[model samples]
Target: MQRNTYGQSPPLHHPVPQHVSTVPQLRSPPPPPGSAQSQQQGYAPTGQQGNPYQQQGGTSGNVFGAYGQFMNDPTAQVAAQFGQTAFKQGQEYVEQNIGRYVNVAALKHYFNVSNSYVINKLFLVLFPWRHKGWSRKQAVGANGQEGWYLSPRDDINSPDMYIPVMGLVTYVLLSTLIAGLKGAFNPELLGVTATTGLSVVIVEIIALKLGCYLLSISSQSQLFDLIAYSGYKFVGIIVTITVAEILNGGKGTGGWIGWAVFAYTFSANALFLLRSLKYVLLPETNGQPSGPMQTDSRAKRNQRTQFLFFYSYIVQLFFMWVLTRA
Candidate 1:
């Protein structure tokens, strides 16, 4: 009321003290070396901070780094794709054609052939003359067994691939052993021998297929049967070579005994193939020739059969000769 002239007596003149708030200062201890917080702050590990020569812990990092460049490389991708494609194609081909060529179940059945049957067949294969009641054309026995048959019995549907495969492997192994005994073993030569023998078999298969084609015979299964039949020559080959090797008696080559055994086996193999393959080479007709036309056709078929039968003999002889050299 004394200074009313200043404005309304200074509005009661209540001097309120100003309040000032202060926060306590904090200094967190510097993060310990190699701690999570320090690492999070982009600090290097304790020993590596100033040492450029510090070696890494594991070498796998370097390995991964080297190969990783190719992981995305276009050329590597192309090569990988190509290899996969080729492998798939080859697998498909084998899956489709292997059974058509080599039937393992049939092979196993034929491989179960008895020793007596083999011996009898061997004799019949060699001589082929009618001996007692056993002839090449005698039907399979009542016991469902092929008895004294040269080739595979017509009724018995087993075309064995096992015997021939075993025979080939045994022949190669024996030949290698013989070469080793003579101090002339060469692994290279062993490979050559295998290739030679395999080529001969392949050629025989091809030739038989060609013959069937030329004859206008549409029997792929029969052609494969013929191949299996032809492979039996390996059995004769093994026998002939073994006999020759034994009779040679360190002579380094066969003598008269070897040649004689070879001759017998060769003839046997030819005869076996002749009787075995006749049905395939010349399928018999149920009807007899009733006219000149029929006779002429029959005669032509007979001539072809004879020619093919002789061809089989010649091929057997050549292959046997090659095998004997081992």
Candidate 2:
């Protein structure tokens, strides 16, 4: 029985193979948590998740803007730039011309006449063809037909040019008429009675209106100021002519009348020439109401000068009425 017990214990043995027990299973371990490899492979991470805010690009709001502003031509912008520059330059020219030491308002008025003179003279000299065309065109009138403002001297389409020339001519003629009237009535003109000229005084009053019209047309030369000054000039010229005639009336028709008329015309012209300098220097700016500032589209013609030149035939009717009444 002792020998049988010892043999049974030695026969007991294990079932598993030696190689299979030594191998470690060779399988992948579970992903830790939120790994990039897990996401790329379409597998879930085990634990800690990723922070999306810390993405590769970081925060975004683009700092750059559009490059080219215009899609078409840029000519309009160029024109506007040049125009603004010219306007500013013109302003500077005016400031420099008047000086820092002159009565601003009075200076402005002087410039009104001066500007018109230069514009017309320049127009005539610079663009004679255009000026000729201006003269040929039928002008509109106050009577509703082709009107006359500057009759003979409308070579320029600008009113400032025509008005002053006509105004000066009218002043001279008015002086002549007054002198003629004085001779008509004054016995002293025949050398018998002693008297100052009276007919001329009345004519001077009427000439004032003509002056007013010119001033109004020229700007700052308003009819009122023009009228008064016109009357004064008439009286001065007429009185001088009349007195000369009275003193020389005894000389018969020895060309005294012609001499006096020549003197009156010349004197008026001299005054005009001097004043015209003001216009030439000051020339009208565009914003003003009158002078060259008036667009050529609106300025018709110089009716007065035309009347003196072409309508001299028509003046007889006016003279007849005035002579008979006065």
Candidate 3:
């Protein structure tokens, strides 16, 4: 049974398609240039589109270029030159002015000794009788000074402070050792002994100077010369003590045997000084004088000889005894 109306048929229905098209769709066009939408879409502004790594490298290159320019600047070069000039001037000033306080040349000359010189000097101090030459060797300086004493290495008779200073230290150490063996050692005992020894030397020098002044003995020797001669007694003192200690079975106190040894040493040291110091106290003369002035010079020379004998015998004996007690 079909019932069809004149104006209306049954409404026809169509199902929607379930499958999508396989063809690629076109994307929306990029937003207009210079618009906020372009920026929001991660597009760089005009004239700024480049690699990020290239921009970073350019920044580093600019920094290095600036540093190079600064280093090559005229002001930096001037500063470097100024620093060098100041250092050079300071060194020159020190060299020029330092001589006022210290005689650097003389110090160097005094210390310019060799191993052979030291060994020979020690042997000479211990056994001075064998050496015949007592006068220091002389040299002619560049300035035509004829009496310049040779260095210790060249002249065995040349005086030096090195041996004296070393002997002083050894004396102090030996005194300490002796004190320890006697069970009387203290830390302060070393200082006391050193002070005593130095005091004795100073007193002896003062006495000798006074004697020279009173006797009108005009010697060309420097103060260090006298000190060097005076310090030689330490060698004899050290030998005497060592022998005494050995004979007495390590005892510091000496007996009759020690006295005998000391006497021999004392006589030997006196003779050594008598021979060595004659050149200093009495200068050699080529001709003898004949007048009142000659007589006066002769008298003064005799007085100086007596003073030397007194110093060599009496002064040395007293000081040597004092050191042995220390």
lDDT of each: 0.64, 0.39, 0.76
Task: For model 2, give the 10-residue run with minimal summed lDDT.
Answer: 60-69
Error of 1 at 253 (Å): 4.3
Candidate 1: segments with Cα more than 4 A from true spot: 1-158, 287-296
lDDT of 1: 0.64
On residues 170-217, what C-alpha lDDT tens digit does candidate 1 reach at each position? 778878888888898998877877887788888888877787666654
lDDT of 3: 0.76
Per-residue alpha-carbon lDDT of model 3 for 1-326, expressed as tens digits? 34477755666688877996788889998677778877555555557755453345334434556768888999988998999999999987887799787666766676778899989888887778999988677787688655567888898888777887788888899889877888888999889988987888788778877875676454444455777788888888887888888897876648887888888888888888888877656554522111112214767888878888999999899999988877
Q: What is the TM-score of each candidate against the true structure?
A: 0.54, 0.24, 0.64
Clashing pairs in 3: none
Query: What shift in Å separates residue 218 of candidate 1 from its native position after superposition?
Result: 3.2
Those runs of model 2 whose alpha carbons end farther than 4 Å from true positions after fitting are 1-221, 232-236, 239-243, 246-293, 298-326
> Of 1 and 3, which scores higher on TM-score?
3
Better of 2 and 3 by lDDT: 3
What is the full ranking by TM-score, best candidate first? 3, 1, 2
How close to the true structure is residue 265 of candidate 1, measured as C-alpha lDDT? 78
- Candidate ordering by lDDT (highest first): 3, 1, 2
Which candidate wins on TM-score?
A: 3
Clashing pairs in 1: 126-268
